[model samples]
Structures are given as structure tokens and as C-alpha cells.
Target chain A: MPAALQATLEFLRAYAGPLIASLVIVAVLPLIAGYVVLVERKVMADMQARLGPMRVGPHGLLQPIADAVKLLLKEDIIPEKADFWIFWLAPLVSVTAAMLSMAALAFGPAFQIARDINVGILFVVGISSLGIFGIVLGGWASNSHYSLIGALRSAAQLVSYETAAGMALVSGLLLGGSLQIRTIVEEQARQGVWFIFLAPVAFFIYMVASIAETNRAPFDLPEAESELVAGYMTEYSGFRWSLYFLAEYANMIVVASVATTLFLGGWMRPFASVRWMGWVDFLPPLLALGVAGYCVYRAPRQPVPVQKLVMLGVAGLCALVALLLAVPLLLPAAFFLKAGIHGAFWFVAKVGAYIFVFMWLRFTLPRYRFDQLMRLGWYFLIPVSIVNVMALGVGLVLHWQYRVNLWLALGGTTLLTLLIALWLVWADRKREAEALQARGGPGTPAADSYAG
Target chain B: MLDKVIFYVFGGIAVVSAALVVTRRNAVHSAVFLITALLATAGIFLQLRAEFLFVVQIILYVGGIMVLFVFVIMLVNLDVALQQIQFSRQKWVALLVTLALAGQVGAMLWWAGQPGKKTLPLPVSVAAPAEKLPANAEAVAHSLFGPYLLPFEIASLLLLVAMIGAVVMAKKKV
Candidate 1:
């Protein structure tokens, strides 16, 4: 081989793991995003008492694949007056930002793509925030009124909620004492508690702010179907639209992972540091086995023979996973595998739970109007998060400076924060009442209008 | 070799996109190019191992400030603006000022490059190996809060004043 070729090979060999991981992520993420969409629809259906996409495959298991095929094969459209370059570029920007953010996220103790950069969590947060450009540019390039409005709303909403989200993350970081994601998780483990238990208010703020950041309901005014006609995505069709969809789901996962890492303890099982709760390590394989068992139980109940076989295949897949999970625990020589495997299981489980809550909220609540959404973010969430951060800081000081019990300090501060939150709500309500009076009472048509 | 490749690639992108930002006819296009330039600059920062600065550049400059820029540009009637003159008649004066600034920077670089000559006090080399460096974010935080605390606070205060000024200007009856 030429020297250049040899040098290239050496470089590739040096970074082969990340290269393969990146390749796998770039390949699998779209499919994962597709399945996330399926899960969302299924969750929506369950909430609404209806079956979702049952005809696609057994229990809509293959619906994402079907949807992917349809989207890929569909006609690509670009409006005549649209900015062609930007129109082409927007979805790629969105997906790139979303996926790039995932590079820094450690899914398990052994699996981190960017290898825990100094500013890992910050990198994730910042890059993911860059996805707003995709929405903004797409909306603008479309040259449509609805798209423009949607993009404008999205930009404003993201900018507003991001402050609160950053502050919330700061509250968590104060406890973690580091910007690196692995360090944050290790801090949680060292402390023998998740930051959620210490900083519940910050977690709550982060949850609400993240939902807004991701543009999920009830904060999803930017894409309100009843009004915006698919919002910034109005002009997009076919693969372009699917790219945007993939970006959205990817962003959801990114935010969920951030929350998992910062608050829920990344890759660490509950009571991870507690020796008495060592039994929790066994929960992963048992949970997988349980899932497998459920699949087997439901296999024979399928209407068709093919469906039954498919169900059985799924059961077998789950069983294989259970076996893989159990092997490290069963054998002493394979003990090194236990942390990586179990950690991944717990990390993914927490992220799944977080995403489930996101979907649950989407199904359970009505969408907020634009102005109301802004008010909630700027007025409620921002102030509460700031207060939460300050209170948490004081709590930490008390725990450190005065040698107060950590839980007691945190609990007292949380109570104080809650009181302040209550006061803020009351004050906001009073202001609203006064504003209503100024607007000639709530009975006026203007007062009742959805002008926002 | 990889580091040099990455640095050159990002530097080239930054320069090209910065040129594009000024040359683009459409306001939104200009804004988009500006964002690309900022992101490329951020990549260069990351290459230099200034991870905190890299993220701050993306978060603060590209994400926050550029969003506002795009938002404002979208709100304005671009057709009206595009129809107007793209540049003012200050080409000669602008060229003179640009040349002066370039000369000053070139002179500084020449001074810094001079071997065994101490024309200026140089800071620690940022290009030191990663293992030799302290954690980037921690070093930044310590400097900002420890010795440079007053300056940082003043800067924040200046920002707060600017924010209040903006609100005041925007308000109808303030």
C-alpha cells in the first residue's frame, strides 16, 4: 500500500470503534425514531380507547417499517416560490443537530460515542438547541403564512423555555459539580441518591421545559394541527418530512437521555450505591424474563397462525436478551460484563420511562395556546426554576457549611421553593384578574378569543 | 495529521461561510450563512480543546442570538428590503479601515512569530496536548468566578442593563 493509504488505515484502526458506532447510530436511529413514533401512536391509542395501526402487523409492531417505506416512496414536493436551497437543507440540519448531540451521550458505562468530552452534557444541550434553526429555516424557506407563523412560534418558544431548562440543569449540575455526563452519574452514585430526590423542583422544571423544548404537547403550539396545518412542516413532503420527523423523535430521545443522566442517574440502577439494595442488580434480567413471559402468554391469543409465530419470535428475542443479561451474573469470569450490560439496561429503562411520561402528557392534556404557552414558560417555569436553583444552592451550602443532614437540608429548601411557587401562582392569578378587569371582564368576546 | 486536517477544514469553512454571510442577497440567507460561520468557528474551538467555549459559541451565539436574528428577519418584509440598495457608498472608507485593522493584526502575528524576541507577553500555549491541560470547563469557571469574578459580574450587569433597555424600548408606555 501507498504511505497515504497506510496512514489512512492506521487512523481508521485507531478510531474504528467510534466509526462503527457512528455508522450504527446513523443507520439505526431512523428506525428507532420510527418505532418511537409507533410507540407514541400506540400510547395515544391506548389513552383514547382505540387500536392504532393494527393492520400493519401484529399489534402494530411493524407499523414503523411500513410507515418508513411509505414515506420513502412518497412524492417529494417543493413549492414553486420556495427558497430551494434552504428548503433542501433544513431537514438535514435538524437531523444532523439531533444526531450530533447524541454523540456525547453515554448510553452505558462502556458506550459513549464522543468518549466523555469535558463539556458532554453542555454539548448535548447546545447542539440540540441548534435544531431550532431547522424549524426556523424550513418555515421561512417555504414562503407560506402557516409555516412562517409556526417557525416564529417555535423560535420564540424554544428561546423562552431554554433559559428555564438551562437553569434547571444548572441546579442538577450544582449537585453533580461537573459538566461531564459520566462525572454527573458518578456523583449521583457517590452520593447514594439520584438528584431527583435532592432537587425535585429542578427535575419538574426540566421536565416541563424539555417538553416545551421538544415542542411536544401541551406546549406544541408551533405545530398545532387545528390551526397551523402541520406548521413549519406544511411545505415538506415524502422523505424530507420523514427527516424532520426523525429529528423530532431524536431530539425527544436526547432530552430524555439528558434528564436520565443528570437527574435519574445515568446507567445506574436505583439505590445503586446502597449495599442493602444489591438485589436491584438482578431486576434487569428478571424484567427481561417477565417481558418474555408476557410475550409467550399472548402468543397463542393472536388471531392468525402467522401472528402467533411472529409473537413467538418476539418472545424468543426477549428470552435471548434475558439470557444475555443473566449470563454475567451467573458466571464469575464474566463479571466485568455485568456493569456495562446492567447499566445500559437501567439507562434505557429510565429514558423509556421519561419518554413514556412525555407521551402520556401528550395524550392526557390539551395543547396550550401560544401566548399561554409563552406565559407558562417565561412567567411560571423560568421564575420557579431560578428560585429552585437558588434554594438548592442554599441547601447545598447548609449541607456543606453547617454540616446539616443532606436530605433535611434539601427537603427544607424544597418546601421553601414550593411556598414561593404557590405565592407566584397566586400573584399571577391576581394579575390575570386585574388584566381581565381592564379588558372589560372575561365575558367579552375578545377575552374569549384565541387571538394567540 | 487528523487534528491539522480538522483545523484546516473548519477554518476554511469559517472563512468561506463568513464571506457568504456578507455576499448573500437575501437577509435570511445571510443569517443562515452567519450561523454556518458561527458553527464552523465553534468546530475550530473544539479542535483547540476549548470545549466550554465551543459549546458557549453554539448555545449563546448561534442558538440564542441567531434565533433572534432569524426571527426578526422573518418578521420583516424581506421583499421590500431586497429591492433596496444592498450596499452603501462607503467602499473606499471601508477598504481603508479593513486594511488598517489587517495591518495591525499582521504586525502582531509577525511580532509573535519572531524567535528570541519578546515584543509581547504570551499566554500559555492553547495547543498543548490534552493530557497536559486542566479540564477546560473547570478552568474557565474558576477564572470567571475566582480572580475575574468582578469583571464577570460587571459583564453580567452590563447584559442586564442592555436587556432592560431593550424592554424599555419595546414597551408601549414605559
Candidate 2:
């Protein structure tokens, strides 16, 4: 072979594992994002006491596929005065950047795409932030007032929340003593405790900031339909609009994965170090079996023959997966397969749980006004996270240099952070009350009343 | 060989995008090119195995500063700016200044290429094995927290002062 060609082949051979993993992830992410939307709709429907999208398939199981087909076939439109090139390119940029961040995600012990990337978390953060460009450009290129304002608002919100999020991540980084996702996970495993226990405040901050970071509700002022009319996506239609939707859900998964790796011990089964908790290894297969059982239970209730067949197929698929998951347990000698299957199951479960919280919050909380969102990010989240970082630093220093007991140091620091947070909240409320008083009375409209 | 190819590719992109940044008529287009140039530079940083610098370049420069630039571009009505003269009346003076700058750079390069002359203190060449060396972020952390601690603290202090100044300036009747 020619030297360059030989080099290329050798490079590919060396990176074949990650290349295949990345390709699989990129190909499947949109479909996975589609399912996440279905789950969100179902959860929202349950919250609102309604059956969501039931007409599409058996219990709306095929709704996402139907939606995808509809989106693909719908007419694509570009406004007359729009910046044509940017309008076309924005969704592509958004989806590409979001997918690129998945490269840094260590999916499981055995399923990682990019192994041992030293700046793994940073890589994810940087690439994901680049997705903001897609939102901003999409909004601007639309040549509409709503889009422009929405994009600007998104930019501001992202920049503010990012500070808090970065600080929160730093606390986890301190506990893990590394930024590489694999090492962080291994650290938690070795230590026999997740970082969340060491830094609950940090984890709390991360939960809030990451929700804002992904533009989820309360913080989804960027796309607040009541205000900006779908915000940056107002001008987008059909496949282009679906691209933005895909990017949002993909970003959510990215953040959840990061949170799982850093705070929830990545793919480690709960109570991993405890001999008594070895039974937890069976949880994944059992969960899959339960899902299959449920699918089977629902199969007969389908009104149409086609829907009944589809439900039966779904149950069969779930059963097949359950069987495969159970195979590792049956063959104890297959350590690699066991680790891979169990690790992926736990990792995905944790991510699902995190995303479920996101959906729950979305259904429960009303949207924040833009000003209120900024206040929460800047005044509350930022300062509290900064204090969390400082407290963590002090605890680590005390433990290392002064020989303080580690848990005691950490506990003291957590207590201090809680006190600081309480004081900040009290002070903010007091200031708000004083401002309200200055505005004359309870009935009098203040300058910044956030009420609808 | 692969590293060299990546470096050249990213370097070419950096150069082209930088030129586009300066030459674009629309301020928004200029800002977009500026982002491209910054991203290209970050790619070069990654090629150099300065992963810390690469991520920092993206996060601090492209993500943060360029976002600010884009905001300013959007806030200022681009239509009015586009209608105005882009180049100043001192085009001759600007041309003269550009020529002088280019001459100075060329002279420096010529002198540096001489056999007997000492070269500029570039970063050490990529000779060390990747695994043997500490990761870039770790090395950077150790240095910043160790020998460079004073300078880092001073830089942070300066940033704090600048932040306070900005707050004061932003406030009404401050």
C-alpha cells in the first residue's frame, strides 16, 4: 500500500472500536431522542390525567415513528427575507454539535466510544456549548423579531447558568480527582461512595443548572411559546424543526450522562462494594422482564389486529432483550459480557431516571420569566455554586494538609454551604420584600412583577 | 504524518477564516468567521496535544468571548452599519501601516531562518510519548497551583477588580 494509505488503514484499525461505537451512537441518537419525546408526552399526559397520542399505535407506542415520517414529508419553508444559507445550516450545526459531544461520553465500562480522553468532560462541555451557535444563528437568520430576541435570551441564559454548572462540576471533579469520565467512574467505585454523597449541594446545583443548560422547563424561556411563539424555532418547519427538537433531547441525554458519570457513579450497580448487594446485578434483567410482562398484558387489549400484532412484537422484543441480559448471569465465566451488559443497563437506567426528573419538573413547574430565570441563575445558583466550590476546596485542603478526618471535613463543609445558601435565600427574599414595600403596597404593581 | 496533516488542515482553515473575518462586509458574517477562526485555532491546539489549551480556547474564547461579539453584532442594527463606509478615509495611512507591519514580520522571519541565529522559544516539539507525559490539564493544574500560584492569584484579583468596575459602570447613578 502507499504510505499515506497504509497510515490511514492503520489509524482506522487502531480506532475501530471507538469508530464503530461512535457510528452506532450517532445513528441511534435521533431514534432514541424520538422515544424520549414519547416518554415525555406519556409522562405529561399522566400528570394531566389524559391519554397522550393513543391514536397512533397501541398506547402510542408507534407515535414517534409516525411523527418522524410526518416531519420528513411536511413542506419545508424559508421566509422571504430570511438569510437563506444560515437558515438552512442552523439545524445541521445544532444537531452536529450535540452529537459531537457524545464522543466524550463514556457510555459504560465496555461501551465507551472514545476511551481515556483526558479532557473528556471539557470536550463534552465545549462541543455542547457550540450547539448554542445553532440556536442563535437559527434565530438571527430567520429575520424575525421573536427569533432574534429568543436567540439573544438563550445566549444570555446559557452563559449565566454555565458558570454555576462549571462550578458544580468542579466539586465533582475534586471528589473524583480527575476529569476523564472513566477515571471518575472508577474513583467512585474504588471509594465505595458516589460523589453525590460527598457533595450533595454541588449535585443539587448541577441538577438545577443542567436543567437550565439543556433549556428544560422553568428555564426554557428561550422557547417559551406563550412569549416568543416557539422562540428560536418559530421560522423552522418540518425536518428542520425536528432537527432542533432532536438537538434539545440529545443535549438532555448528554447532560444526564455527565451527571450520571460524575455524581451517580457511572455504570456501577448500587451498593457495588457490598457483598450483600450482589443481587442488585439481577435488577436489569428483572426490569426488562417486567417491561415484557407489561407489554404482554397490554397486547390483548389493542382494538385493531395490526395494533395487537405490533404490541405482541414489542413484548417479544422486550423478552428477547431480557433473555440476553439474563444470559450473562447464567454463564458466570463470561465476565466481559456480564460487565458490559450490566454496566450499560445501570448507566442507561440512571440516565433515564435523570431524564424522568426533567420531565417531572417540566410538568410540575410553571415557566420562569426571563428576568426571574436570570436572577435564579446569577444571584442564586452562581453564588451558591461558588461557595460550594470554596467549601469543597477547604475540605480537601483540611483533609490533606491538616489531617482532618475526611468525612468530618466534608460534613462540616456541606453544613457551611447549607448555611450560606439559607442566608442567601433569606437575604434575597428580604430584598424583594423591601422593594415591594418601597413600591407602596401589596396590590400596587412593582416594576418586576413576574405574574402572568 | 497524520498529525502533520491535521496541523496543516487546521492551520489553513485558521488562516482563511481569519482573513474572512477581517474582509467580511456584514458584521454578523465577520463574527461568524471570527468564530470559525477561533475553532480552527482550537483544532491546532488539539493537534499540538495541548488539550488544556484546546478546551480553554473553545470554552473561554469561542464559547464566551465570541458569543459576546455575536450579541454586540445583533444588538447594533446591522443595516445602518452596512450602509456606512467600512474602511476609513485614511485608507492610504492604513495601507502604509499594513505594509510596515508585514515588513516587520518578514524581517523577523528572515532573521530567524538564519543558520547561526537562535530561534524563537517555541513550545517543545512533540517528542515525548503520549502516555509517558502527564495529561495537559493535569500539568497545567499542577503548574498553576504550584509555581505559578502567585501570578494566577494576581490575575484573578485583576479579574475581580474588572468585574466590580463593570458592575459599577452598568448601574444607574453608580
Candidate 3:
């Protein structure tokens, strides 16, 4: 072979693992995002007393695939006045940033693409933040008022919440004492407790800030449908629109994974450090088997033969997974396999639970006005998170420097933070009342309500 | 070989994007190019193994500052500005200044490449072995909070003052 070809082969050989992993992620993520959307629709339907998309396939299992096909086959459109180059590139930027952030995330002990990056979690945050450019650029390129306003709202919302989010993450990082995703999880294992219980306030702040950061409902003033027609996405259609949708879902997963690794103990089973909780290791396989059994039980109730066959197929698939999970536990020689597989199961489960909570909130809560969203981020969340960080720091100092009981220190600090948060809320309410009085009366409504 | 290739690619991107940032007629396009340049610079930091700096550059510069830049650019009426003269009247002066800076940089590069010449003045103790060097974030934290704590605090105070000035300026009734 020629020298250049030989060199290329050598590089490929060295990077084959990450290369394959990257390929898998790029291929699978869009499908995963689609399923997530389907789940969200189903959840919303359940909450709202309706069935979601049952016409597509068995229980709408294939709706995402159908949607994907439709999106791919749709006509691509661009406005006459649009900036052609940026319009073409914007969605690609969004999706690329969203997916690139995943490179640093540790999905399991054995599954990480860019392993051993010193600034792992920060890398994810920083790269994901870069996706804002996509929104801003797309909005600008569309040459539409709605798109520009939506993009601007998004930019402001993201910038405001990111500060609180970063501060909350700092509180967690102080406890973990590391930036590497793997190290953070390992620290939780070493501590015999998750960071959530120790720094509950930080976790709460992170949860709220993350929702706002991802532009989910209640905090989703950026693309508020009744206001801006799909926000920054007003001009996009077909595959390009799908790319933006995929990026949003991918961002959800990324934030969920970050929360899991930092506060929910990444891939560890519940009570992971407790020696008496060894039985939890068996729970994964048993849970899969339980799912399989439930599927089998429901298979006969399907109204159509095709639905029944699909249900049976799902059961079989679950059964195979259960077997796969069980075999490694039974065999001592496959220790790494057990750890890797079980770790992945728990990690994905926690991430799913997080996403479910996100969907639940989306269905339950009313969307906040843009001003209210900004107030909550800047006035409420920011101050509380800052105070929480300081209190947590003090608690850490007490625990390490003054020989205070760990639980006592953390619990005391948490209570103190809560009290401070209460005081802040009361003060804000008072200020709002005063401002209302200054505006003449409460009946008149706030002047800035529709400012955005 | 891989590291050199990666560095050159990123360096080339940074330079090209930076040039485009100044040359773009549209303000939004200029902001986008600036973001590209910032991202490319962050890549260079990653290549140099200054991991904390890499993320900080992305988070603070590309993410925070560039977003604000784009926001301001969008809020402004760009059509009127775009229709204005693209170049300033200081062409000769600008070229002269650019040439002088280029000459200074070229001279420095030549001096560094000279045989048996010490490129940088440094204490022997500052050059630690790679194995003994602290993690990037730890080293930064140590310096920021340890010996440089006073300076860091002062800088934060400076930022606070600037922030107050901005708020005061933006407030209608203040």
C-alpha cells in the first residue's frame, strides 16, 4: 500500500473504538429522540384523557419511524429574503453541538467516547451552550420577525438560566470534588450516598434551571406557540426542521444524563455502597423479566391480530434482554460484562425517569410569561443557587475542618438554605406588591407583562 | 504527527474565521464568524491540554460573550449599517500598523528558532515533569485561590463596578 493509505489505516486502527461508538451514536440518537417524542405524546395524551397516534402502528410504536419518513420526504423550503448560507448551516450546527456534547458523557462505566477528558462535565455544558448560535443564526437567516424574537428570547432565557445552572452544578461538584463525569459518580460511591441527599437545594435548582435551559414548558417562553409561531423554528421545514427537533430532544437527554451522573449516582444501583443491599444487583434482570411478563399478559388483549403479534414480539425481546442481564450475574468469569451491562441499565433508567419528570411537568404546568420566566431565573433561582452554594461550602468546611457530623452539617445547611430561599421569595412577593401599588392598582395588571 | 496536524487545522480555522469576522458585510454574519473563531481558539486550548481553559473559553467567550454580541447585533438595525461604506478611511495607517506588528512577531519567531538560544526566561522550578504536574483545573484553582487570591478578588470587584454601571445606565428612572 502507499504511505498515505498505510497512515490512514494506522489512524483508523487506533481510533476504531471511538469511531464505531460515534457512528453508533449518530445513527441511533435520532431514532432515540423520535421515540422520546412518542413517549412524550403518549404521556401527554394519558394525562389529557386521549390516545396518541394509534393509527400509525401497534400502539403507535412505529409512529416515530413514520414521522421520520414523512419528514425526510417533505419539500424543503427557503424564503426569498433568507440568508441562504446560514439557513443551510444553522440546523447542522444545532444538531452537531447537541451530539458533540454527548461525546463527554459517561453513559456507563464502560461506555464513554472521549474518556479521561479532564473537563468532562464542563465540556458537555460548554459545547451544548454553543447550540444557541444555531437558534440565533436560524432566526436571523429566516428574515422573519417571529423567528428573530423567538431567537432573542431563547438567547436571553438560556443566558440567564445557565448562570444558576452552573452555580448549582458547582455545589454538586464541590461535594464530588472533580470535573470528570466518572470521578463524580465514583465519589458518590465512595461517600455511600448520592449528592442529591447532601445538596438537595442544589439539585432542585439544577432541575429547574435545566428545564429552563432546555426550553421546556412553563419556562419555554422562547418558542411559546400562542405567541411566536414555533419560535426560532418558524422558517425551517422538512429534514432541517427535524434536525432542530432532534437537537432539542438530544439536549434533553444530555441534561438528564448530566443530572444523573452528578446527583443520581450515574450508573450505580440504589443503596450501592450498602453491603446489605446486594440483592439490588438482581433487580435489573428481575425487572426486565417482570416487564416481559406484563407484555405477555397484555398481548392477548390487543384488538387486532397484528397488535397481538407485536405485543408478543415485544415480550420476547424483553425476555431476551432479561436473559442477557441474568447470564452475566450467574457467571463469575463475566464480571466486567455484569458491571457494564448493569451499569448501563441503571444509567439509562435514571435518565428515563428524569425525562419522564420533564414530560410530566410539561403536561401539568401552565407556561410562564416571558417576564415571569426571566424573574424566576434571575431573581429567584440565581439568588437561591448562590446562597445554596455558599451554605454547602460552609457545610463542607464544617464536616472536614471542624469535625462536624456529615449528615448534621449537610442537613443543617440544607435547612438553612431553605429558610433563606423562603425569605427571598417573601421579599420578592413584597417587592412585587409594592410595584403593583406603584402602578396604581393590582386590577390594572403589570405594565411589563407583554413587554417581550 | 496527529497533534501537529490537529493544531494546524484549528489554527488555520481560527485565522480564517477571524479575518472573515472583520470582512463580513452583515453584522450577524460577522458575529457568527467571531463565534467560529472563538470555537477554533478553544480547540487550540484543548490541543494544548489546557482543558479548563478550553471549556472556559467556550463557556465564557463563545457561549456567553458571543451570544450577547449576536443579541445586540440582532437588536440593532443592520440594514442601514450594511448599506454604509464597508471600509474606513484609515487604510494606509492601518496597513502600516499591521506591517509593524507582523514584523515584530516575525522577529520574535526568528529569535526563538535560533540555535542554542533560550526562547523564554523561566525559573527551573517552574518547569515541572509531566507526570508530577497537577490536573489542569486543580492547578488553576490553586493559583486563583492561593497566591493570586487578592488579585482575583480585586478583579471581581472591578467586574461588580462595571455591572453596576451597566444597570444604572439601562435603568430608566435611575
Candidate 4:
């Protein structure tokens, strides 16, 4: 080998895990995340008097991989007038933006790709914000009129939502007292309380922000072909087009993963009775790594079987997570039982539930207008999230004076939340009734929408 | 040996791609070349063992910001760069200014260079330590919040301000 080649090999050898891990993650994360998409679709299908994607597998398990192959082999076209190079670079930018955040996500107690970054949560925000560029460029480079308008809409829309999202994430970071992902997870493990209980308002804001960030369902106005002719992708075809789809779905996965790590106690189970089992504290970390590895290696070749294995593994991991959380309350036996019931089972169950909701909204909701989307993000989510952050801060300061128990604090927040929800619902119904009275009669539909 | 391999491979590519970024006739082509240059610089960061910076450089710079640059180049809708945008009689003036900028950078770097040590100032490891990671992380956390906390907080606030400014600039106020 030449001298430079020899040196390059050594460098690769030295930093093997991260370099290897990044490459591996780039390849498999899309596959894993896309399966969640299929699961979402199927779950939604069953929810509304129908079955979905059952023919692909015994229960449509292999649908994602099947979809992947279809995308890969699909026809790709390029417009003559398009700025071809920029159009090509757009999807790579989107996909790469989503994947790069993994460096800061330390998965296990010791199995982190890199460690000790002081500004991790901030780094994630900074880097993820860059996704705006991809959307803008993708829209513009297509050289179609629709694309430019769509890209413009996306640029404004994303910027507004991202601020709200960043503030929502800040609420989570404040509860942890440190920015590191692993430490945050361990805090939840030690306290046996997830941030969701403490920061329910933040959690709701984040879920909404994440949906918009991923450009999923009703928030996907930028790509709604009914108006903008495929939005930014009107001029793209072939592998290039598929790249954009992959990147979009991959970003959704990334957002979900962030949600998991931040508010879902990461790989820290809600129950960890296994730690008392002598070397059981190690299982949550192991399960995390094992699933990531197994999905990467086995998912491509035998996707149906691999997905089944992964799903089962997630259920088990959920139980473990629950057990880990309950160790404070339950001792070793309680830990194991909860791991079986709460920790390992809960993650898979929640992820499954979230995916179902994702698909449900996908099928049922009408796409928002670009202006409406922006208004929702800025006017609604941002203010609410800011209020939540201030409330959490107030609660934290008052903790010492009040001698407030964690459960009591949680109960108080929960009750406050219930009251707010009820009021919002009543207010919405009143507004609807008033609008109906103004329009003509209660039975008459609005002129603009048939569904009404 | 590894250092030399990285230097020759990525550094060479970086230099070539950067040259192409300016020299290419097509604006879109120039953007692609810039992406290549950015990727190679990320490789250099990887070789230097700043994994966090390396990832951010690619994710934020190569993937995020550069894509916007390409978008603007494409959306501005030029069949090609007009004579005004390309080489002109003022080309010599532009070239001279670029050279002056380079010289200034070179002089500053030369002043900062420590010949005593081989590499620039940064923590070194092929990867993070398998053990002692939490200690390393804690030290980093302490350093960030301890001495560098002011600058770190300022950077985040600056970003938030910039974000707000961008929204203001882009939005059509009704």
C-alpha cells in the first residue's frame, strides 16, 4: 500500500467505534425508523374499521422493507432547467442533519459513541436547526415555481416551530440539571420518575413540535402536491427523489429517538430489578446496544423476521426499563416483575402507541395551510411552552420552601393539566357553536369544507 | 503513519475541492465542490480527534448551511453567471483582496503556531476513553459551566436572537 493509504488505515483503526458507528447508523436508522412508519400505518388502519398492510407479512410486518425496495428501484428523473447539483445535494443534507445528532446520544452507561461534551443539548439544537437549509435548498434548486414557494413556506414554518421546540427541550434539560443524555437517563432511573410526569406541558409541546419538525401528516404542507406540485421535489426523479423520501422519514425517526432519549428516560427502564440480580443494571444498556446492532445486521436481509425479533426485544426492553425505575420501590423481585411489566414492556408499548397516533393523524387530519401551520407553531405552541418552562422553574424554586413530595408535585401538575384541557375543550365547542349560528344553522355545513 | 494518511488523503482533497469551489463556472457546480471541501475538512477534524466538532462540522455546516447556499444559488434563477457576476476588469482587484486576506490568516496562524508540539491545541484520543469517560465528561461539563459558561450561554442566546431575526426578515408582516 502507498504511504498515505497506510496512514489512513491506522487512523480508521484508532477511531474505529465512532467512524464505524456513524456509518452503521446512517445505513440502518432509516430502515428502523421506516418500519415504525409501516407500523403506524397498520395500526391506524385497524383503528378506523379497516386492516392495513397485512399481505406483506403474516400481519404486514415486512411492509417497510418492501416499501424500501420499491423506493430504491423506482424511476428517477431530472428536469432540464433544474439546478441539478443543488437538487442532488438537498436530500443528503436532510439525511445527514438527522444522523449527526447521534454523537451526543450516549445510549448506555458506558456504550457511548463519544462522551463529555459540555454543550450536548445545545449542540443538538444548533445542528438540528440546520435542517432548514435542506428544505429551502431542495425547494429552490428544483427550478420549478412551486418549489420556490414551497421552500419559502418551509423556511418560515420550520424557523418558527424550531424555537418552540428548542424551548420545549429546554424544559426537559432544566429538570435533569445537566445536558448529558446518559446522565439525564440515569437521573430518571435514580428518581424513578420520568420528566413526562413533571413536565407534561413541555411533553405535549414537544410532541407537537416534533410532528412539525418531521414534516409529517397535517404539518406536511411544504410537500402537499395538491397545491405546489410535489412542493420542492417537482423536478427530481430516480435515486435522488428516493433520497429525499428516505431523508424525510429518517428525520422523523431522529425526532422520535430524541423524544425517547430526552423525556422517555432513554434506555433507562422504568423498572431495573435486574440490577439486584447481580449485574442486572447492565441489561438496559445491553438491550439498547443489542437491538441497535441486531437491527443493523439482520434487518436488511430478513426484514420480516428481524422486525419481529426487534419488536419482541423492544417489549422486553420496555419491561426492563420499568423494572429499573421501580428498584427504589420494589427491591430485586419488584424490579424483575416491573421489568417484565413496566420497564421493558413500556418502551415498546409507548413507541407503538406513539406510532399508532402518528398514522391515525396521517389518515384522519387535513393538511394545514402554510400560514395556518406557522400560526399554530408561533401563536399556540411557543407561548404554551414558555408558560410551561416558567411553571417548572417556579415549582423547582418552591420545592425547598414547600417540602413538596415528588408525587404531590406530580399530582398537582396533573390536576392543573386536566383542568386546562377541560377548559380548552369547552371553549372550542362554544366557538364551534357560535360559528355554526353565524353561518346559517347547526345542520348546515361550511361552504369551504364538505366534511363539516 | 495514520496522521500522514489522513493529511495526504483528506487535506489534498480539501485543497482541490476548495480550488474548484471558486474556479467552477456554474454556480451550482461551485456549491457541490464546496460540499466536497467541507466533507474533507470534517475528515481532517476526525483525524484530529475532535469527534464532536467533526460531527457538527458535517451536520451543521456541510449538511445544513451549505444546502441553503446551494438553494439560493439555484433559486436566484440564472442560466449562468452573467459577466457582472463572473470575471471582470475588477477581477485583479478581487484576486488581490483575496490574496491579502489569505496572507493575513497565514500571518496570524504563524504567530499562534507552536513548533514545540506537533498538533494544534485540543484533546487527543483516537476515540473517547472506554473507561474514565464520565470523568472526562464531568471535566468537560465543569469547564463549560465553570470558566467558559459565559461564552457558551452567550452563543446560545446569540443563536436564538439570530433565529428570531431570520424569522422577522423572512415573514410577510400583515
lDDT of each residue in A251-314, candidate 4, tens digit only: 6655665677678776555544345554554554456556556544544454476556655555
TM per candidate comes to 0.95, 0.94, 0.94, 0.69
Question: Alpha-carbon error at B41 in model 4, in Å?
Answer: 5.7
Where model 3 places Cα greater than 4 Å from the true spot, the runs are A1-7, A442-452, B118-133, B172-174
Interface RMSD of 4: 5.4
Docking class of 1: medium
lDDT of 1 by residue, B66-142 (tens): 99999999989998999989888999999999999999988987897798876653332355777789999989988
Model 3 TM-score, all chains together: 0.94
TM-score for predicted model 2 compared with the true structure: 0.94
Q: Chain B TM per candidate, please? A: 0.89, 0.82, 0.84, 0.72
lDDT score for residue A115 of model 2: 75
**Model 1 misplaced regions, further than 4 Å:** A1-7, A442-452, B117-127
Predicted candidate 3: interface RMSD?
Answer: 1.2
Q: What is the C-alpha RMSD of each candidate to the true structure, in Å?
A: 3.1, 3.2, 3.7, 8.5
Per-residue lDDT of candidate 2, residues A1-452 (tens digit) = 58779779878988898898889998899899999999999999999999898988899988999999999999999999999988998899899999999998877788877676788999998889899999999999999999998899999989999999999999999999887988999999999999899999999999999999888997898898999999999999999999999999999999999999999999998999999989987877888899999999988888999999999899899999999889989886765698788888889999999999999999999999888888888879999999999999999999999999989999999999999999999988888888778876684666446767
The 10-residue segment with the lowest total lDDT in model 2 chain A = A440-449
Give the candidate number with the greatest TM-score.
Answer: 1
Ranking 1 against 2 by TM-score, winner: 1
Query: Model 3, A284-305: lDDT tens per residue?
Result: 8999999999999998888889
